[model samples]
Target: MKYPVTVYGDPLLRKKAKAIEKDHPKLDEIIENMWETMYYSDGVGLAAPQVGLSIRLFVIDASSGADEEPELEGFKKVFINPEIIETKGDEWTMNEGCLSLPEIREDVSRHDEVTIKYLDENFVEHTETYKGFAGRVIQHEYDHLEGILFVDYLSPLRKRLLKGKLIAISKGKVRPHYRIKVPK
Candidate 1:
């Protein structure tokens, strides 16, 4: 089932998520629901906090295209209690946005490549190396688990410029339209 995504400035978004202790009865169902919610919302990634859950879980599928492609495929992957064990290369700037902070996009500097160790939906441990846009998406979602937002990477001036919008979002003065369907 699709769930409501918490908007920016929600206090829950700032609280660090708690780690999932074990594979419990509803863990699989929760993860599945998260994936459905994410795809329904047209998001590349979504964290538990975004859905009002304070668990260290996030889902991502960064296999979308840059521009030219006519269609994008979902390579959905789940990360439960993920950690970036290593990073390499200089920071690269990419235009980034989030489901929590809607209608806002900014250029943020992030590591071009990263090696992350994480548990999958089945609770199996795995490690993977990612680069380019895929890597950036992973890092961004990872930050959500730690109570961090991409806007935090902005300079004081940039952040200040966006203050009004952020405040409006937090106060529910403005609502964002979530594109919930993916083109087949």
Candidate 2:
């Protein structure tokens, strides 16, 4: 199923997500639906909150071509209740965008490599290290689980200039009836 993506300024996008308690009836279905929604939208990642779900879940597949590396193949990954256990090295700046924010893209600084601990789709625990573009995608999707958007990293001046546009987006002026609601 292709779920609706909440746009910028949606209250649900600002609220931190709650951790998934256990393997539930619709968990697997939701993951599958999210992947379908993400691929349909040409997004590298999709968080539960983006689809108006408040659970701490997100999907990432960074197997796309990067500016530095063009021949990279993508991989599909799902992170449930994920945490960055370790991060090393200096920050790298990359132009980042979000599915929720539509066409907006901004330069954001993130760690070049990270080690993350997360629960997989089958409820198995795993820890893996990622570098380069994969690392960036992980960090980006992880931020969504915490209610952080890529625009939050923008400069104060730029943010101020974009405030009206963001507000209009949130209010559904630009894309009416497309916003999804977070389940209470």
Candidate 3:
């Protein structure tokens, strides 16, 4: 079943997520549910906290947009307790949106490449480097585990301008196509 996405104002989104142990209960089932929720919401990436679980986990599937970025074909991955080892290359801007902050998209700047260490669904370790679109997506989702939001990267003036919209989202005044859990 698809979980209602935990929205922006939820305190869960502001807290650092916990790492998952190899023997975490129902691990496989959780991953499957996350994928279902992500696809159902038309999200390229979904972090555990976004699903009301404060765990260091996220999934990414960018293959749906492979036509524009051929390298993203089959770029599906499951990250458990991911650690970003290095972020290099010039910073670039990309218009990004999040399921947690529905209807809000902004230009966010992030590194062009990143090297990370993470365990896969089977608890197998893998260290990989990604660049361009894949790298940006990874960085975005990784930040969620750190209790950071993409809007935090915006300039002060921009943030002030968006304050009203942000509050509206928190108050559950927006109508996103997918289900969402607003802050109490």
Candidate 4:
């Protein structure tokens, strides 16, 4: 089943997610649903919080058809109880968008590489390092687990400029290509 993506106004999006146990009930099913919902929403990544589940889980598939980022090709993976061990290298700016934030996109600066420890769908633990677009995607999704939006990285002036637009999104005034659940 595909879950409706939660909009920015949802309080759950602002809450830090909790880590799930290895024996989390229906873990596999939830991961499957996340993938389905992500594809339906045409997002490269989706955090559990984006679906109104305050759990430490996310899914990513950065296979661009145009081979724009070759490193991201076939980079599908499921992250459960993920922890960023370290972030290294220089910071670079990239335009980032979120399933929860809808039409808003902004250039956020992030490290060029990241080392993360996480569990897979089967509860298998692994530590991996990613670079370039893959690292950016991971960092973006990881922020969701910590209740941090990309907009938070923007300057005060930039944030102020976009305040109205952000409020509009929170109020469900924006139209995204995919389905979203707005706060009542």
Predictions in order: lDDT: 0.82, 0.81, 0.95, 0.91
All candidates: CA RMSD in angstroms? 5.1, 2.9, 0.8, 1.3
TM accuracy, model 3: 0.98
Using TM-score as the measure, the top candidate is 3
Model 3 ranges with Cα > 4 A deviation: none
TM per candidate: 0.89, 0.88, 0.98, 0.95
Give me the displacement of residue 107 in model 2, in angstroms.
0.9
lDDT of 2 by residue, 14-84 (tens): 88898886656699899999998888888888999999888889998777755566534656788999988
> What is the C-alpha lDDT profile of model 1 across 1-184, one tens digit per residue?
8878888877778898998967555887888888888887788899999888899999887667535332225556889889999888889998998888878899999998899999987788999997777788889998999999999999999999999998777776665565322111
Q: What are the clash counts of all predictions, listed in order?
A: 1, 1, 0, 0
lDDT of 3 at 82: 99
> What tens-digit string does per-residue lDDT give for candidate 3 at 89-183?
99999999999999999999999999999999989999999998888989999999999999999999999999999999999999998999999
**Colliding residue pairs in candidate 3:** none
Best model number under lDDT: 3
Please estimate how well model 1 matches the true structure, expressed as its whole-model Cα lDDT: 0.82
List runs of model 2 lying over 4 Å from the truth. Answer: 66-74, 175-184
Candidate 3 weakest lDDT stretch, 10 residues:
62-71
